[model samples]
Target: MAEVHSRSSHRELRVQAGASDNVTANELFDIEEQRNRLSRMFCFDGMGGALLIEPSFPGCGMIDAGKGDLIYSNALYEIKAGDRLFRSVDVRQLITYSALNYVSKRFQIDSLGLFNPRVGVSATIPVDDLCAEISGKQSSDLFFDIVAAISSGDISR
Candidate 1:
């Protein structure tokens, strides 16, 4: 079993192309939803060592509008690994994943909450594994093997 780490449940926010009368065009506001894949999260392990996963995991995400305004955004998520909130295992995964997956692909991140002070990053792993590692029942070595296959020589960079 995976070790239980810190956990701080946060609300997921999604900004639509057009702003409503209640909210200003550039003003930040809070809204609630049960769950949205665009802003959903998954963990690799039990907060021990994990990464954050969203719709644009392998790409820097953006919300484009027909007008001149180009809305760029990324999901704000917090992971709880250990005593540290947002600066532990998940941090490396976020940096590694973002670098290897999105940055390597030339995806742009409008803003990041990985190590922001404003947001409380819970260092706990989510129940799901976006990579399907759990269901596959593959050991760590096997998982790395799969990663090796998927990444090939590109992962070295």
Candidate 2:
């Protein structure tokens, strides 16, 4: 079981897991606490400012992805609610968000970041580097191919 406290709503959310779970309820609660703390740390003003939390990006023709944890100025942040460092999947997701946000030209993200509040670890990379890394991946070509196929309405190869 985990009790999460929301600062914005001033309410508590309780979450419970099976007793056979590997993670304890206290750990879950701690993770949620860290997430809330991180959100508050970056948010400016009560409404809108430079920081936007959990902003969703509607899918274009190929992909629809969003709900980014935070966006400060030109930087987009993805929060990981765990004590461990950022994993490859976390980086990939942030990079994707950055790339999509940039392509959309609506947000123009300049950088991407992964933050883990539990261990106080954070990695920030420029959008260009992220794009390069993503491009270098072998799967990138396949991903683009899929997008192209979807756009052309020709999935059958």
Candidate 3:
């Protein structure tokens, strides 16, 4: 179980679990605190409008997309807290978010990036290059299929 505590402008979510567990309660608490700290760091007022934390995208359901982690003025950032190396799936996710942003015309996604603070590594791809790569892989059809399924609400097949 988890207990949420709110004090002033700070919020903490504490999970209670045994020490022997694979992920102990203290670990969960630490993770939540780190996330909150990162959120604060990327917050608009704190970052001088450089980044917006967890900005919502309207009509994301049309493409089965979710809110992105952070949004820079000209790009979208997906933060991976763990030390895991960046993968193709991560690139695909950012590309999909870029595509959705393009279609929505809310924010023109100039670039996409994967940031891993744990390892202090980052990779960025220009939206045009990403789109070209997806096209070269012939994956655009699959992406469109997903959008079609979501729009029709008949993903079952």
Candidate 4:
């Protein structure tokens, strides 16, 4: 996978599969650690572009990558989810997000594993309504499009 880039900002964060150590749920239980890691990737991804990785904390504990104790950050990227995932249109949006960011892209009330699930299920739906459903909403629907695709196995990296 290519390294994430961000040019408009000074804080760049790019966590390649082997470039740097991956932060496990056990290691990122604390807010500071999660912030630091996310900040790094944020700066890296949004180097020239303007974007932010806001961690859904306090009450946004629905996407469980590890224990609900661990945190998840919602990323705003300029690229499409398929581009990020490095997959064809056969992949789903949430799955693409998971593959690209190395973070779980959640769906529904259940914590379905995005990276690799024991039982796979389609998780695609209209993003317009979902984007409207969230507070502090940002215009980053590419991820949603990818989710819509991946849920149906139609992703193109």
TM-score of 4: 0.21
Judge candidate 2 against the unseen true structure and give its global Cα lDDT, from 0 to 1. Answer: 0.62
Which candidate model has the greater TM-score, 1 or 3?
3
Candidate 4 per-residue lDDT, tens place, 1-157, comes to 1222344434433333433367654433433444454444434433334332322212112332322211112322222222123233333333333333332443222121122111112233233333444323432454444334445544433
TM-score of each: 0.26, 0.59, 0.58, 0.21
- Model 3 residue 20 CA deviation (Å) reads 18
lDDT of each: 0.34, 0.62, 0.61, 0.32
Off by over 4 Å in 2: 1-49, 134-157
Task: Please give the distance, in angstroms, between residue 61's alpha carbon in candidate 1 and its true position after superposition.
Answer: 22
- 1 or 3, which is superior by lDDT? 3
lDDT-superior candidate, 2 or 4: 2
* lDDT of model 4 at position 133: 49
Q: Tens digit of lDDT per residue, candidate 1, span 45-133?
A: 23322223332433222211111101113322433323344444554454334333333433343333343222423222222232333
RMSD of each: 15.3, 7.4, 7.3, 15.4
lDDT of 2 by residue, 35-61 (tens): 566655554335433655576665545
Instruction: Order candidates by TM-score, high to low.
Output: 2, 3, 1, 4
TM-score of 3: 0.58
- Worst-scoring 10-residue span by lDDT in model 2: 1-10
Backbone clashes counted, model 4: 33
